[model samples]
Target: MLRYYGVDLLDLHRGTLSARRVLVLIRHLPRDSALVRALHGEEADWGAVEHLLAAVVDHLAIGNWLFTSAHGDSEPPRPEPVPRPGDAREEETAATPSPRELAAFFGGL
Candidate 1:
């Protein structure tokens, strides 16, 4: 695609490509205005009809997917956390001695 734009592949990877240099390459395009419009997702100029579709495909390929909820119908709902009941109430009702009481009881023993 860069070659199609008359751009050097090495320049793009080297990060040495200047904005003006890229513009110069784009100017070589037969339909510069139409390429710009396609990149921006707008209607292309009549003169650029042949290459406008390809430009749109190229630009849109860089975007992330945007899908509706219905598209992923198989996804399961997230589960809520459940807390376990503590044993404090059961121990108290059963006359089980507290830690302090048990310590004193054992110390006396």
Candidate 2:
């Protein structure tokens, strides 16, 4: 979530990302954001970006799915991430965000 959302998982794990500014960053990812550009724009390094960000792309998909399901809102269709060779399915999400910290995310509002 760093590139697009500007809040790293580490911050979330540390119970920091829910701060008002950070939550604003995460919730306000614009359509023309850099992550969207890399995903849909004429990216030059399919090989490198795919290898480096394959997991990130998957997480984006999952996050989008979760958001849509939770809110019951249909977002605009976006292209699926390119499948990686062998599809490294190692354990991701090592540092799940603290629910208690997230509780404060909305409190600042």
Report the Cα RMSD per candidate: 22.9, 20.9
TM-score of each: 0.25, 0.27
**Candidate 2's residue-wise lDDT over 6-96, tens digit each?**
5577776698666776656745665466764565554423456566687787778878877776787565455466565443433344455
Candidate 1: residue 78 Cα off by (Å) = 64
lDDT of 2 at 43: 40
- Candidate 2: residue 88 Cα off by (Å): 10
Each candidate's lDDT (Cα)? 0.54, 0.62
Pairs clashing within candidate 2: none
Report the error of model 1 at residue 89, Å: 79
